[model samples]
Target: MTHKIAILGASGYTGAELVRLIATHPEMEIVALAAERKAGMEMRDVFPHLRHLDLPTLVKIGEIDFSTVDLCFCALPHKTSQEVISALPADLKIVDLSADFRLRDPEAYETWYGNPHSAIEMQKEAVYGLTEFYRDQIKNARLVAGTGCNAATGQFALRPLIEADVIDLDEIIMDLKCGVSGAGRALKENLLHAELAEGYHAYAVGGTHRHLGEFDQEFSAIAGREVKIQFTPHLLPTNRGILATCYVKGDAQVIHKAFENAYADEPFIELLPLGQAPSTKHIRGSNFCHIGVVADRIEGRTIVVAALDNLTKGSSGQALQNANLMLGVEETTGLMLAPLFP
Candidate 1:
């Protein structure tokens, strides 16, 4: 059965990535595209790369008929996602690519997001959309919240270690770097070509990045206690990809074994051989995440790294993965495309 899919905030990078992936999905069709600011323009006008496809014209969210859509991919901004999704039809399955519903606690949401969740009821029902960890839950969920690109990359490298009791939870440190596209299609002085093209710098230092809310939620849940990690993110000048290096107190062989055993047969997650690390370029434009493990100079410490395309596995591709499960279709369908390499 072909599912009718709608993308809200189609003018953004993540939305265009969704269109790029869904254009090849055998069981899904793009039926509606919404971009409030670019509402009257054709999708081709907003993204010339998508000019070849026969896609729906861009419209405001209010102009679309939700009843005909099987699922909706919400790629709107953080605070705006909650408002837009709150007004959507109740029966529609939603995959929100925003921070609006990621944190389970409403108080934490307000603290980090700077506003009370507008859709409290929906927030309560939204499933965290980390495809590997929450596969079963996502399959039956009505609303799925896609993770932050940085958070997803960090978790991929460390979740298994925490689960297997192989790492010191208190000492986990993640230093991540992401490309400019992860910043979205917004215009800012810092994101200008002249400013960002040849430099790299870290932001959200001192454990202040909002995606920490997700790291806190998932890690605490897995360890059955509070697990906080030191996280810092840097912006790179490239177009896409995230490389997260996680430092932990653990035995190298044990850490490798834990991740290898956990993702032995997973579709989108690939565990590289010991001492062989993964690069962001290897997973570009695909929904695959590659994780590697190596021993640190210290006897009882290990370094784990994970890489993936922030726009694909980190956002839109992840949204589609969850949507497939929610719709009872094969989880890996249309998502098995090989990563692009230089």
Candidate 2:
């Protein structure tokens, strides 16, 4: 029962990651790969790290025959994903790794992304792709929307406490540090070696980062009320991880207990010891999220920190996990690789 998989935007970082993970997948095979500008080039040529993989030559999205592809992973840019996905076969299953279909409301999408969504019907139909929380929904979904790397890391830190009512909703603050790879492979003046090699700095401050929409939407839905959280993200000098430190008003022990209970059965979520903290180095290049909780020096203040590879657990790895569920395959297949440690 091998499922035929297709990848769009194959030249991008996330798309190449999907190809890397699926190359070892037991029940999945790459049938076709599409890239707008990289079409006619071999994947191994575009990404030399993938030279060992015998993947198909990249083609334009319109050139591939979707009927032969059991599932497609769209790793294109935001607005581009909506347009491309809208034109895909109506019944073809899809896992979109862009900001396009994540926000359910067209107005909310416009507010966050500054563009009205082109696929309203598909947007409403797409399930959120946070695999642990949205497993059941993803298994039956025709389309799945992958979460923002920052959003996913923050949610992992706060979702349990929010669900348990153990934290002060109004006082929540998430300060995250992410590796530059989360920015995609696109060239940018800020991402140059000279600029990013020596230091790191915060970019999205004061809730201006778009992922806040997800935090607001998901956190609000879980608490059954409007929950506005202060989120600030920093870009680190490294290449592939996200470390989020969350501040909240709560009992540290109680928060630990809540996290333990919630993530006990979740395979990819690793809850650390009480008063301990996690570093992105431990979970790099894997589909595992390490969480730690410690009490702040101030009374009633607790800190929760979470770490995961932004491209793995945060994006491509998550897309594969959802695809497994949607295809009725074992959810953890080809995704149980251990985190790379130094």
Candidate 3:
């Protein structure tokens, strides 16, 4: 019952993470590794840390025989993934880690990503890959769209509140800080060590971030109305993790109870005790999300904070979780590795 897996765009951080996790999976085997830019090179050549394992040589996506791959993890860039995935066999189960099939509406996709979705039919069929909330859907889906790291962090803190109607919807605000690796492995002048270290600043202020689309869509769907929150994300100097502090007008105890009750059966979500707060360092390099809730100093207000590794639980790990459901394998397989702690 072993499932053959293929990882497209295997040279990036998230792709490498998939390799690291899949290497230990008992029921899954990596049969194809595709990295168009790094084609003909061994994965060990691109990532020396992986030099010890015998891995498939990196090839272009078009060169792989999809019929032999039971499932594929698409970790390519935003628009690039849609084009590559569209060409993949329709029967192949896929877990896409890019922004391609996340937004269901093609207009919303075009509005936020600035282009029409190339795979409209496939987009319509793809299920949202929020494991805890969409388990059944993911299990039967031909394609699952992995959420944005920032979006997933925010939702982990707020989804329960929205579903329970325990918060004032109009007053919801999320302030998030993310490590630089969430921006991707691509070289950017701003991401240089000298420029990013020692200073942290906010970008995508005033609802300008693309992940806001997910917050709006999911929140609105849950509440059965238009739900828009003020979302601001900051780029921190570190290499991993995302911390989202969500502000809401509600009872702190009630919010805590809601999260605790909602995540009681979830394996990867840990709801901290009341008045405690989560830190990014605690869940670094793990497929775990820690959430904490506290009463704000102001009356009728509460703060919910969530922490998770952007590359692991936030992306590739999530892709693997969804793929497990699709393939009828144990959801926690290969994902139970403990968080890296100092």
Candidate 4:
């Protein structure tokens, strides 16, 4: 029952993370690794931390025989993901960790990503991979689009509220903080140790961040109207996790009850006791999300905080969770590893 897996973009942060998780999966095996730039090198050579396991040498995407791969984890860059996935076998099951397939409308995709989607027909078939909310769809999907880490974190805090009509959709505000690794493993001057260390700053201010497209899509769909939250993301100095602090107009006790009821049967989503907040340190390197709710001093206002490993529950771990459903295997398999903490 082992699923033969191929990881495209194997040298990136999310790609290496897939390798780390799959190494321990009881029913999935990595049969190929593709990183066009890193072709002809061993995965361990590119990521020494992975030196402990035996894996295929990195190869260009064109060199792999997709016909043999039971499932593929497309961890490539956004535009690149659509281009590569468009040409793969039609029947190949895929979990895409890119923004490419996440938004359903090609026009909206172009509006946010600045280019027309290259694979329109494929977009039509792609299911949004917000595991908890779309479990049934994911189980039957051939292609699942993983959500942005920030989007995932925010939705965990607010989706239930929106669904229950317990919060005012008009006044939602999400101030999120994300670790640098969420930016990907690509080298950039801003991400340089000297520049990023000791200082924290916010980017994509004023509703320009692309993850807004996701928020717009999901929230609007849930509220049955155009729901846009004031979202501002700050870059953290560390290497993992996302903390989304959301402000909403709602009854505090009702908000807490809504979340507790919504996630009561879910495995990965944890609802903390009232007045207690979750920290990124608590969920590092684990496929778990901790959500906390607290009432503001002002009546009818609530603050919801959600924390998760940006690389794990935020990205790679999410991809694997959808892959499990698509493969008809236990959804929690190979993903119960505890969070790493000091």
User: What TM-score would every model get versus the actual structure?
Assistant: 0.99, 0.99, 0.99, 0.99
| Least accurate 10 contiguous residues by lDDT in model 3 | 204-213
Off by over 4 Å in 1: none
* Candidate order, lDDT descending: 4, 2, 3, 1
> Which stretches in model 3 have alpha-carbon errors above 4 Å?
none
lDDT of each: 0.93, 0.94, 0.94, 0.95
- Between candidates 2 and 4, the lDDT winner: 4
> Per-residue lDDT tens digits of candidate 4, residues 1-342?
999999999999999999999999999999999999989999889999999999999999999999899999999998888989989999999999999999999999999999989999999999999999999999999999999999999999999999999998899999999999999998899999999999999999999999999999999999899998999999999999899999999998999999988999999999999989999999999999999999999999999999999999999999999999999999999999999977
How well is each residue in 90-195 modelled by candidate 1, as lDDT tens digits? 8899999999999999999999989987888998899999999999999999999999999899988988888999988889889999999998898989999999
lDDT of candidate model 4 versus the reference: 0.95
Deviation in Å, model 3, residue 107 alpha carbon? 0.3
Candidate 2 has an lDDT of 0.94
> lDDT: which candidate is best?
4
User: What are the root-mean-square deviations of the candidates from the true structure over C-alphas?
Assistant: 0.8, 0.7, 0.7, 0.6
lDDT, candidate 2, 1-342, per-residue tens: 999999999999999999989999999999999998999999989999999999899999999999999999999988899999999899999999999999987899999999888889888899999999999999999999999999999999999899999999999988999999999999999999999998979997787899989998899999999999888899999999999999999999999999999999999999999989999889988999999999999999999999999999999999999999999999999999998888
- Model 2: residues with Cα > 4 Å off, grouped in runs: none
Model 3, span 109-216: residue lDDT tens: 999999988989888899999999999999999999999999999999999999999999999888999999999999999999999999999998887799989998
